[model samples]
Target: MMVNDPNLFWFGCVLWLVIIWLIVSLRHSNKVDSPTESNTAGAREIEELRQECLRLREELQMQSKQLKTDFQNATFSQLQTLLNNYPSVRKMTEAKPDLPAKNLVSLFTSLDNLLASWGYEQIGSAWEQVPYNPQLHQPDTNDIAEGELVYIRFVGYREGSRILSPAKVSRTLPISSPSK
Candidate 1:
């Protein structure tokens, strides 16, 4: 049947308008909800990545500390062994007073090699012909004179810029003339 009446035509137009408005509103709501949902998911992903980065940093710090501890332990053990053997080496040299100079040289070369491997060096000079400096040497007696080194009581050692030990020494004094 044809809708020839004015009232009926107006009702049909109103119904179609309501349907189009409902469709547009539903699409708009979906578009708005989609971004909100996607944003929430994005925020969760970003937080997870941040937590992972923090965990990795902590692990690296732990590994670095462990490596330092291990290195210190190894160095300590090596030094302990060297110190333990030092007395025997000294005794052997003292007992063999007539030992060849070349043999003594070889023995000192081996000792130097050992010290070098541990990042250490002998600090005192063999022939103390130079003037004594308070920074490098500790005077054994108060009467130690200025020029010549009389004797070395103990040898010193150095590691980099640090003085591990001081050289213990006695200096020669000029003899005083007897009054006539």
Candidate 2:
């Protein structure tokens, strides 16, 4: 083999330097690219976290609404039960003097609140003494007055405009004098 020329040797050295420089620069570039890739992944994770939070909030709202609906239904059902038990309660009151009237009144007021919560209310005029109307009064005829309603025996109830029950009334009657 011929001995290498000086110019050729110098060119070879220069070529080797260029190749080394390219290799080192490529390694550094790869290092920088990895951090950028990791940052992009981190950003994607944050976006996913945000989406999950939104989904949870929506679920909470739906559950809250459902709870409110269930509560209202339960309250209405309680009111219906209280109203249906009224006849039996009145009979018990007649049999037992020890049963407190105040306690019974408080229970009725609680029932009124329950009704009001579900958009029903005790009839206001039911408390006031009024003339007997066949349309408004349903009497058992056991308790008789004379001509018109002497008193409202129990409170009437309604839901909006629809009457739940007519007022139980006693009619006024003329007292006959003993024959002289």
Estimate the TM-score of every prediction: 0.41, 0.39
RMSD of each: 25.3, 25.3
Candidate 1 lDDT, 101-151, residue by residue in tens: 325444555666766776766555432344666666667776766665554
Off by over 4 Å in 2: 1-33, 84-103, 115-180
What would you estimate as the lDDT of candidate 2?
0.56
The per-residue C-alpha lDDT of model 1 at residue 30 equals: 59
Backbone clashes for every candidate come to: 0, 7
Q: How high is the lDDT of residue 55 in model 2?
A: 72
